[model samples]
Target: MQQRAAITLALASLLAIGLSGCGASEAVETSPTSTSGQGSTTYPLTIDNCGTQTVVTAPPQRVVSLDQDSTEILLSLGLADHLVGTASWTDPVLDSLAAANSGVPRLSDNAPSYEVVLGTDPDFVTASFGRHFAQGGVASRERFAETGIGSYLSPTDCDNGISINGGGTRTHALTIDALYEEITELGAIFDVPDRAATLIDGLKTRAAAATEGVDFAGATVAFWFADTKTPYMAGGLSAAGLLAKTVDLDNVFSSSPEDWPATTWEAVADRDPHVLVLGDLQRDRFPGDRLDDKISFLESDPLTQTIDAVRNKRYIVLHGAELNPSIRFVDGLEKIQSWLREHKDEL
Candidate 1:
């Protein structure tokens, strides 16, 4: 009787083990889930990606750019067709880009929240600024990875050091040349390399002509920006410096410790420049009011009246997209050179 009972118990144990194995096998057989957009073959949009290795096939159809520069970059690339949504940072310029894409719907009134991004059902997201990837912000690279969405960073401010956004910051030694090269690279990604090459070469030619100097090889210029409230001026290594180089003006701020450095009114008194490039005009003043008001301010301001630029009326006011880092920067250079030419007799 005992032997029979033991035999039945052994058989029961084996049966239980077999049933557990079947359950484990069923779990293993369940199909893995994936992000929605990859069902269709994701077409290759070859990306130069700033300095990153070329991406052969980047799946970025419904793109959401986080900042104004990123939005403008995308617009310039002629990839507006793939843009699903964008932010308010595009401001006054992209009204036309927006009108054309109005039917596509907005991702956010501001930099997008994660919820808004998810609801849009995006395949990929790209941004000019990295703030979107900060703690709790939408489209953080790590979080996007979880959902199998890709992200691309614009060369303007990679890895988020000291970023001068509206005001351009010079990163590489060959800042202007680098920008042109990157433009060509972008064209390749869009399958419009010829168009990109044409644009770059044309801009380079224009920039070269603008900088073809009468003289400034020995003279320094005060590349002033912003108001006296914050006292922001560009250094020799800043975007202002690059602009100065284009016009062949020596940068007075080369010794400045910071890119946008604050100096005492005394400092301006000390390193007074031959020309004053007032790149930052009064925000409320229209472009037309600039020359007159700047002339008046230079004459009236006790500190400015003694400066060579002020005495000679060599103050130049750069406006619109010219002041921004968009391709129009060369146009700003051309305008500055024109001002210098107009005042050549006095200098």
Candidate 2:
């Protein structure tokens, strides 16, 4: 209770630093997803993913995606026809992925066994996290290559030269740029560069429009990814961090190096964020984790009840699909920006 009270006090002390002159009225612009979009891409394209250099001799006809983010990406690129099998994370919110996956063979609810994945006869596979390709995981890149299967991992999970599991030690911050790059790369690999370019353009336009009138510079934001004894926070380098920054909010956990850090209630109390951004995950996995439950925690807790944002009922919710690195990143940004617009007075 004392911890919650301290959080409320800290937030009360910071409320006077109002967010003014923080929003950029002019459309904030970013470079195109990739530089290779200028000219036609030649076949047999080889690119380094994670730590492996994969050469695509031709467009893969049968694909198996090991994660929701990868499956959603394939769906967004109109590659549903190419997907022969999939192993999705539980209860992904993307409508198109769900619809496209209806007829697709379920390799597994989570990561499928090596023999099971191989049984799907997939020519290509993609996973959002590098851990999927690690030892004792779905399968290693070498094993896939031995079977003439190509694999790709989302850049967000890759490090540089230093190997961690099946990924590198490169700690590139997950941002819209990375999302665009993934889309563009997949398009080129699938022989649909034009489609990828069009999709990226549309995404950028929507993102720009979402921020038109919203200034978020000084707003302290906290992303509660889970409801455990210790809260899970989105690190400054992850996709959630990028979303927070997109709206110009100062992420309380932005300084943490880990992509998702587990910290105590005292830490959250210290930050006393102005707005709480909750990442809504699947109910099956987190039965008691709901937006209402979190809100209740804030409203009922003696210490937390005094927090300015909680006292005033300022909260924003983002689905897991929207919070992860994938085609829906722009959509997530737009949603949060819209929410902030609705609660502009709180800022």
**Candidate 2 structure quality by residue, lDDT tens digits, 1-347:** 00000110111212122221111111112233333333345545666665577777667778899987777666766677788888856445365345655777778777789899888888888888777788768888778888888888776565563333353433666657666667667777776665566666667677778778777867898888776567777878777888877778888999875666788767887788898887666654553256667776778777767666676777888776666776666667777877876888767
Per-residue lDDT of 343 in model 1: 72
Per-residue alpha-carbon lDDT of candidate 1 for residues 1-347, written as tens digits (9 for 90 to 100): 00000110111211121111111001112122212324222324334343332332533566676655555555654556667777744234434354434544566656777878777676666665455765555655657756755665555443123323323344543266445544444444344443444455556666667778746665778766655534456676655666776667788877763455776556775788887777544343232224455556558879868887777766767653354345657667777778778877766
lDDT of 1 at 192: 43
Poorly placed runs, candidate 2 (over 4 Å): 1-41, 90-93, 96-98, 161-172, 286-289, 300-307
lDDT (CA) per prediction? 0.54, 0.68
Best by TM-score: 2
